[model samples]
Target chain A: MINSPERVAPDTLARVQAEIERLGFRPSRAAQSLKQERAGAWGLELNSAGFGRLGAILDTFLIELTTGAAERGSHVVPFTAADSAEPLPAYERLVASRVADGFVLTDTRRDDPRPAWLEAHRVPYAAFGRVWDDPGITSWVDVDGASGVDAAVRHLADQGYERIGYLGWPEGSPVGDDRRSGWVRATTDLGLAHPEWQATSTQSLPAACRAAAGLLDQLGLPGRSARPGRPGRSGPGVAIVCASDALALGAWRVLVERGLEPGVDVGLVCFDDTDIAEALDLSSLHQPLDRVAERVLHLLATGPDSRDPAGGLLLPPELVVRSSSKPAGNRTTRKEK
Target chain B: MINSPERVAPDTLARVQAEIERLGFRPSRAAQSLKQERAGAWGLELNSAGFGRLGAILDTFLIELTTGAAERGSHVVPFTAADSAEPLPAYERLVASRVADGFVLTDTRRDDPRPAWLEAHRVPYAAFGRVWDDPGITSWVDVDGASGVDAAVRHLADQGYERIGYLGWPEGSPVGDDRRSGWVRATTDLGLAHPEWQATSTQSLPAACRAAAGLLDQLGLPGRSARPGRPGRSGPGVAIVCASDALALGAWRVLVERGLEPGVDVGLVCFDDTDIAEALDLSSLHQPLDRVAERVLHLLATGPDSRDPAGGLLLPPELVVRSSSKPAGNRTTRKEK
Candidate 1:
């Protein structure tokens, strides 16, 4: 009845569309692939360096993406680096060999040569991360890291933690920079910006712990005065936000070693809600990789011919509030033995 | 020089052959593939159930295998389950479509229908796990879990831990059963067999922790006694072996909660030397996944034409000795706060 143009009114059409959107109706991809002669696979070009120490976010994302692809009656064809410096040959071969219908590019950076190469060759691709320079070249799906961190910082402030600190990766890393930029935005907006409180380190548990310890030690000293008109509230309610779960885990350990209660004395927010966070019951920003995969698959299936200029989708991350971020006296905060 | 039959003496040829064997020369796969008209891609059929949790072993193996394949100028084509119970359609399509030269099978079980299906269809395939029904049906590369656990048990006994318990997954898992068999063999041989001391639980950290605590509390109470020859040792030296790193991590936490110092009052050994083992400094059995990948790739490249009766390779696992396996007197173990 809804499909009949003669009987269905404009309001009925709108209501049906709204219901479909609310219910998240995805068309059967197996049937769609059969109808369109789809290759039923998408190629993913992985960085060789990532294989050394598998990133938890990337590992989980891959699993979710594979599940998403399998649900859609498709699969992800992984192609690794032949030459790390020059990966164009492998990309060219993938196109020439017809192994996959399209590609999904991950770990996108500023001035990334991949989008250019893909544009020049007119290969169908959907990037998982955004490129800085020619946004019109390809469709992409990126988690709004800046917004995620911005929300995380605000949440910390709302938890009554005034002296919030941030631990992030070193400069020049686009991904880390994006996350830090969010913290910057939040700190500035909240009137809690502390230049001495910010720190950077390599993305390892040990390195992050050291950096976090340095930040915490330097945070609540005599030289660091309380805010104007707000005495005796300088650093007792300190909070720390990390760019990743690894850094947060490190900070948690440092806090424990320093005899400061994590959830009561210091609020902690971690990006990437991996298994570690779950095990430790830490608050974290969870990226919706399943939705991202769905959107990326949609763009890839649309192909290059139908490429739209404003096709980039920036999805918001959900904040999972656990015991780690609860304010003092909150029953949700679990006591450490 | 050995190529020249007329100029080279027989003794010289023999010496050169011995040197070549010592050097461990592997022929370039690119040249071999070119001469043989290789499809340049291998198929991997992944189960949907495995995708749910994304086992760390499988994840690492995939990365290593993909890297190995890329180094050999080939790529892995992963075809996942469209139907969980019936995966042959996907395999049949891969063959009918000529998208892959051969397949690599993982997580093989008793009376697995896949081997028989491939055999009847004349599809070239190599398994990563052993098939119990007929060893001669196909080539396989398996990690010797029995030997790995046997070595772990002996190492614990050597560490002055007389009563070594095993925490493993519930019955019906082949891999878990294999590891338990090793423990049983070692316990029976060492006269420390206590049937009630063994416990089984789910593979999660919390479940394993609860199970570990139960085993520890129920042990050495009344019924369980020290080995007949060892009258001096009662319950002084107690240790545990886990089937995986997750379980080991749980056991460590339980030990800590009970105020017992790990690597001091208790010994721990985990299988799969993943990041957790390194981060926690627990001793583990490291599987030779790189070598396994090498052997699997070799069998795949050989195709079904060169199927040998005794082609199965069961590689022994290497146990890495760390502070966790060290005896109480050893000062090498780092003291926890």
Candidate 2:
């Protein structure tokens, strides 16, 4: 069996180094070779576990980066992650031979081994999402989910919906937590007394829909805490901000089944304006796919040191007010701004 | 600069050959290093744009094949051909890096430069789709589109519509011809005269919709046919089979705008039940994505030389009966079946 790098003989390393040199790469050998060959394409390794929204978002982000880079002449390579989602063997081969130029890691856990693997190999990689325990050495692009929640909250408040609710994936997800933070911030800023159980999360969309139902039950609009409903803005209207469109759509389906018109009876806002959102006219925060794609590619090609980029590029997402979430007074909001 | 085998200096060749021996590989040490480390991933360097349905079918077939391999402990890597639709530089890297365990090529054109490239580089591969001229090659899998089209025609005939038209891509597309041939043969078997003017291919959906308007105006409902006084098949229902769902949806949109319901007024069938098709509730040929993904992996891991599985594989598609296409019965061959 071939030994690990630790057990590789000195002479063998020298010979491999010489072989690598003959490949027309510099002495930084493995690193230089990898860096030089980086412009070809991105090789992402992922597996499908049915409804992988996180996977979808990460993939979309990665592809956008690659597409953007391709416009500038670089390519993106999609390498499916092994079933285990462990890429050690793959990494060893590529690093040893200086194959992939760079990488973009996604679905990073709190103590992600992927970022460390790339870091230790001196590989130039950027994480699609961020890691909390990151060593400050890794570069990553993340969504300002908090801001999205805030937008939803402000819209709901303007529409005179005092009792708004937030629904989505478990807080274990970094993004979910960020979104929740924004929700809390917005409610606190408006001096609204948010009930402790007004928010909920679940793994599946059906589960999320169920949770939304429960939240609505707990925060019943008929309780009459705030009287005198305004035109198109008052009543027991509830604003639901979801982490993803699938969840949001699922909620909308439930509402419709119960004879409640989404965007009218209950304002619904979902993230990621995927095609489904457009067909249903579900209001969403439009993530600029084109711009994101370009940025990802630029970082991969130009090098990680190219500049951290402004605010790390939190592309402003447009609050597309559709039937789900009305405007600030014209249709849904309390006052016209 | 590094030179090809023919242009290499004898001394340099000998030195490289010696290094290759040291690495337990042949020729360039780089290639040997890659071949020695086989990750459970297969590489497919097929053209995405020009490859045709044959290419897409092979892709679906491969996805099916790969699922099994993955289940058996292996993953497949999906990659596209270069912009020029060739793999010279891309293939070079794939070969030397041992990126894919084997090569699987789809949509192999008649004058394919890929086979030659593979042969010159000693890469092992399989073909899923093939150009008709390569009759002697036993390395491919092809779906009998003629039969598929026949089934579609028969299905349409079972319904009560007469007056039919074929929505197809350019004839150069292998699968397109196969399906069109099926359509024509079905009509012939029914002893009905097929009209050439009924077929059409536009640059895009909007164009197709515009053309559809004209077709509808000319072949108006039973009593509305341009040839006045002659009553067409009661209601003179029409069925359109688009080469792709995108086009089918476009046609459906046009019909709806003109106050015509798809399944009720006119029948439609599309190929490749893409995402849009499912939500739109349109009938189509369901490409077995799971089976295809599984099969590709299986062929890559077990069928090919495992050194380079960049060949093609074709999987059968399923005809999903939706409301869009009426049930056949007394339907005229001119209408559909």
Candidate 3:
């Protein structure tokens, strides 16, 4: 038996409106053709570079999106570069066949070539993310990485830590760069300088750990005295904020092992508060994935140029303070373990 | 700048053929109406019933499956039961929309109603698990829960525990039932009667701890000479094989607090082998989710009417013995910290 509305998610009621809209629609051409013929016809298109979890994430999201379309009495045929060595040919063929209505595009680079390609060919499509150099694209929804980063840094600053440093990601990644910008802006507001102590780390946990140690080591010596009354209380009580909680957790482990109390002597924060953050009790900024997913789906549903080009939306992130960002030396700190 | 074919997901490539056919054939009048007025479309359908991590896993599989479609330059729309009060409506609407060319379904319950619904409507779709009863719908891929349970129980029993009890989920869940049956079969074969210490718990960690204690209390003091056994061998070495690693960890916490060493004096085993399992060194069964996802996607891409008379496909599970289920009285067992 199904439970009450209170027990169910809020999204459960959206179908009624969709059903209402469908009721007003005319009979499908496919239905007429199927009655006259036996074969089913449908089309699907996909294009992107593959990265493990990323590829995995994109695949799952697409399949799920398509499943609903299928239930609505449509037959979807999937298209991808997997069918051919070159993605351009498959894409062109779908458009040329006039069998597919439009294309769905993802992995759009900062200076993506596809938006112009699709537009020049007069094909209506939606983008999973935005392309910076191309302004003529029709519709697109993207995660606002800058705002997410800003939230992470702001939370750390609010928690009373000075001399914040950002453990950055690989150079030139648009998303990573945006997050790093947030960190810089936050630190700048406090009139703090970016020290050479900050370092870069790849996504690996051990790499993040090393980067964390590198940052603190630049402070020079575990028991060293701060340079007199300029008053940042410089010994070890520095805040280390990182892009992606993965690096943060890695850095956190290193701090714990170094005999420094987290939240007291050292502050650690990470972006993207995922399951790992919850498990390790790492302080982090939680990105609104649901909101992002909804926005992306909305853009994908509607063609590019369907919405206002000048309007961009940014969702706020929540900060959850665990042992990693709290002031150390308190008795409650030791008891947390 | 996004690299194409060399970086594409290979499995997704295989399904692009069907998309090619869809793009090539406008088919009949019904097909034309079903075709997009502007572009190709597919979607992600989030079943409204259980919207948690398992749901995420299923969603990810679908997204991965569609990677081939996207690469081929087709569009898919992800629509879920977020608005539908139930999963059945989402399934039904997917069939009616005429917007999707294919469908992907998952989180099949023990007695699912969606399979028959899909079959009756004749919509081709893939399922992640089999419904225990239906003969009409045929096509599903699932993890083999029984063998996983069998392997875990036997491993624990081999680790010098004479009598082990099955600490499972409620008596009815298909996964739980399958695992418990395996546990019972294994223990009985090893010449131990099924003990009455069977207890169940819901989602809470504290509740699971209570369940463990209650189950042990039901055993009626194993050290007494009430039954045929050696003096003071008490409590069957008390190996509690749990349904999931999360549940096992919950019960283990309770065991530790109650003067019993989890890996030594009291045995524990869990399923899923998630991140926590490795971190806590909990012995567990590793179900190959990545493989299961692949097979599920393959079946969906191939038309979803796989294995006949219930369309069942079983995948193997492996046993990973950690410190959590060590032999009773092992040197590694800490003396009740």
**Comparing 2 and 3 by lDDT, which wins?**
3
Best by TM-score: 1
For residue A74, model 1's alpha carbon misses the true position, in angstroms, by: 5.8
- lDDT value, residue A319 of candidate 1: 94
Q: Tens digits of per-residue lDDT for model 3 on B225-307?
A: 24343224355576778887657756665554443556766778888775446545678887666666566555655564444
**Residue B168 in candidate 1, Cα distance off native in Å:** 1.4
Top model number, lDDT: 1
Clashes of each: 0, 63, 91
- Candidate 1 vs 2: which has more DockQ: 1
A59-113: candidate 1 lDDT, tens digit per residue: 5566566667766656777877667678778777655545566788887877677
lDDT per residue as tens, model 2, B74-146: 4344554445455666665555544455576666666777766765666656565553555544455555666
What is the descending TM-score order? 1, 3, 2
lDDT tens string, model 2, A1-337? Answer: 1225557788888787687678754222222223344324455544443212321344344434543644564444444445435667655544443335567665666766777777776777765566567646537656677887788778777866666777767767776787778878888898865746455656454465567666656655321123333223345567777777767755665564344556666777888775446545677877765665665555566676664644345555667767677733446334210
Candidate 1 per-residue lDDT over residues B1-337, each given as its tens digit: 5446668888888887888789754343333333454546778865645532312666667776787887777778776666757778778766654456678888788767888898897778888888767867658889999999999999898888877888888988888899899999988888878766778877666677778878777655211132222122335588888888778877776665454556776788989887767666689999998899988998877777786657688999999987787865866645442
